[model samples]
Target: MLLKIGLVVIGVVILYVVVQVLLYKRDMKKTKEDLLTFVTKNKKDVSVTIIENDDVVLEWNADQKTPLASTVKLVVLFHFVKAVSSGAIKLEEKVALSDIERFYIDRTDGGAHAYWLEVNDFSEHATLLDVAKGMMQFSSNACTDYLIDRLGLEKINDQMKQAGLTEHDELMPLTPMILWSAYVSDRRRDAFKKMSGVSEEQYKSLMNEIFNIMKNDPEHKKALEEKMKKKNLLGWRIQSLLTQKLTKSTTNQYAHFMKLPG
Candidate 1:
């Protein structure tokens, strides 16, 4: 009886792994055009534009405000390059690994932070250059928040304007999506209450407020961290609210950004 039960469990595990592999392979076979068609047609909540040689090639919801999500990291990368070129920040500047780890919220980033650390194989610390590489290459939010602390948020937002990205929303720290959701779970306030009253200035302020606590106030930060660690806070409602708040820009603006001088 034991042997039979163990065999059944093993078979189930094997089947699950095989299904996952097949799905991954199927997704890998999809071309850029296939992806675009699928997203634009099926995911009707998308804003996309394709520009070639200063000419508009394709567009959908071109002028509509679209959430940037992780794409906001591109702005960070652009600014980091400019800072290095202008002799503002050195590539060799070393940062303690613990400092970077502090900003990392586990499980929210789809394991990006852990994966970056694994691939880089750094022990206690890494250079600013490697950190920046992790930020762009791995899309690590931890790596980004570290840079944001080192480089002022105001300066980063100024890069968008300097690059003629008038439509781009202000850059805010990314970890708050998880932390603030946890706050809502603790019954401090609901998602709608938090989002509805927030203007651009108020939104930016709240983001900075959370980020400051993470950097400075250990006890408060610990409480928030415990909330995240102990409970699952993100629900459909908070996610919907976040989708509205997480940086937004038009499809045309995104394409325009790609055309800017690097």
Candidate 2:
């Protein structure tokens, strides 16, 4: 009687295991179908992958190139962390805010997201750690520009390449200010050409010169402003054009820097 009861228990356990396996397979099939349907309906050019226990479970266009956007900041942070480890930059070292960096705070516009430090949070100065935190946490472009200046771009690029991003070109050469300036210059190129009577190349050079003067020489900036005002060329709606060009990224790429558990 005892032997028969033991056999019945084993049969019940086997049935339960089979049922669980079947349910799992059904759920997986539904998940795949749903994902494919959504991607098809939305017409999204995306890559999705699922891995389990060192195995590729599902992949759809996983090899397609996707723009990293602010995700590139992870490379910057990776280098920054390395520099700190190598005794190149001290964590407590203070980074002073430039006039342009402070513009986000001074301007009443809702452009900057003060995640870690306000305009006056540290009185025109924040520690390297604070800047790093701001760059990652707030995605502050200005903070990124400052850190890039502190840690050479070439070093960051080398670090990224060594870490298996060898195929990604044009990922490390741009700083936040450079990207912003490029975007603005592209938007204003036509207007600048009409105003200066110069070719596209010449117009870009002149814009760079003007940008330098505005950032460095206050007297020259005032002169340029007065000249524009006198010539009635100061009323172009450049800001609206900028709005059209500053496209936001859909995903958070900064999280790529984190060392995940295996």
Candidate 3:
């Protein structure tokens, strides 16, 4: 009788394990199906990665290299946090408003340029955390531009390279009209003057610096190659243009545009 009772207990435990395993697999299948359906319905090229209990359980790339619209803000926030943590930028450090940030605010709020704008009165004060929050929540152009300037484009690009996302691209800040025109037309020469707001001589010098860096960096070269291999022809082309410091249309002409390079 004792032996029979022990066997019954063991069989019941085995059944419970089997039931749990079956339920887990069913849930996973349902999740994948739901994700695929949503992507298809929206006609969006997106990549979904799921982690469960510290393990990656699902990876679906509708279009992995496609430029993420506002999602790139996440990368900007990531870098901001890193910079603060590393003591490269102090959280309490005050960054005075530049012409760029002021311009953005004026245009956004329909304020006049000649009007006096103070830090507390100028619509907003830009702190380290405020910048990060702006990037993450609103994907604010002014906030992103400010952060990029403070952090250095090269530093951000390097962090992206280290993160293993190499296909992301960035352009220098430009005027709204010029930026919009470039986005619409994808013309480099016409927008060059408008975007950089510098003399031709200065622009030429800046281009040379960017070219030297791209020409010398092995990781950048490899990332471009990998992007090409993935059949992201537009992305490959955009990287080439950026390396040459040639202004293109909108930055998102290619598919995914992550703030970090993959």
Candidate 4:
């Protein structure tokens, strides 16, 4: 009777293990199905590329040149790492929060920079590496813009080509988009009008002109911040235009960018 009970106990344990395995597989299948449903629902609005081991494992709108918006920071982040590796930017370098604020506007960026400030009690300054972390971690536009200035826009674009990212558009400063709302000297002061009427090349030139002042002149940078702080200029309407206009790249090239050796 004791021997029979022990065998029954062992059989029960094996049955429990098998049931758990079956449940786990079912859950995994459900998760994949859910993810596919979500992606299919939003595929019209998004570009997605997933790469593994230098292979195009998945892609949607991969060849379409799409505006990167904040994801442009990925290219900038790549350049920052390259600069550090080449001994150009010291990781421990001191950076003033005041200087970063020059590029920051109060309401833009969905409070990313503000959130970074609240959590990091750096007093007056933080290191370059820390700021870079905030760029990726918090999506801080201020940190991104500051690093763009520090890293040099020309060099950033050059490195994009060096990385064989043929689909990339030129890297430029942010915060200038708000200035296009009847506040600037351009003919198409209204953002939507410019989008509707101007050629792609013209719009790009306009952004370049705005960024040049921010790049070369400190006073213009301060002026830009003040204007952007106003933030009441129907800016949300230009979301689609921004993705098409600003520093666009194909999902394909960015997929390749992901495969690069750091």
Worst 10 residues of 1 by lDDT: 1-10
lDDT of 4 by residue, 53-143 (tens): 7667888888888778777887887787777767787878999887888677667777778878887888999999778767766778879
**Evaluation by lDDT, superior candidate among 1 and 4:** 1
Badly placed stretches (over 4 Å) of model 4 are 1-38, 41-44, 185-191, 212-231
RMSD of 3: 18.2
lDDT of each: 0.75, 0.50, 0.45, 0.71
Candidates arranged by TM-score, highest first: 1, 4, 2, 3
Residues 1-262 of candidate 1: C-alpha lDDT, one tens digit per residue: 3344335334533543454455368677779999778786766687779998899999888888878887787777777777776778877898999898878776777777887798779979899977876676666888988898788889999878988888888888888656775554565346557666777887777788888877777577778878756654566676778878888888888788877654
Model 2, span 1-262: residue lDDT tens: 3344335333433543454465357675567689778889865566655655655676766554555545566667667766876778787887776543622322212233453465437787778876766665555665665676578756776776576554454333222222232323333455544443454455445444544554467565555444443443323354443332222222212222232221
Better of 1 and 3 by lDDT: 1
* Residue 160 C-alpha lDDT in model 2: 63
User: lDDT by residue for model 3 over 63-87, one digit each (tens)?
Assistant: 3444444445445555665676577
Compare the candidates by lDDT and give the number of the best one.
Answer: 1
Query: What order do you get sorting by lDDT, best first?
Result: 1, 4, 2, 3
Better of 2 and 3 by lDDT: 2
Model 4 earns a TM-score of: 0.75
> 126, model 4: CA deviation in Å?
1.4
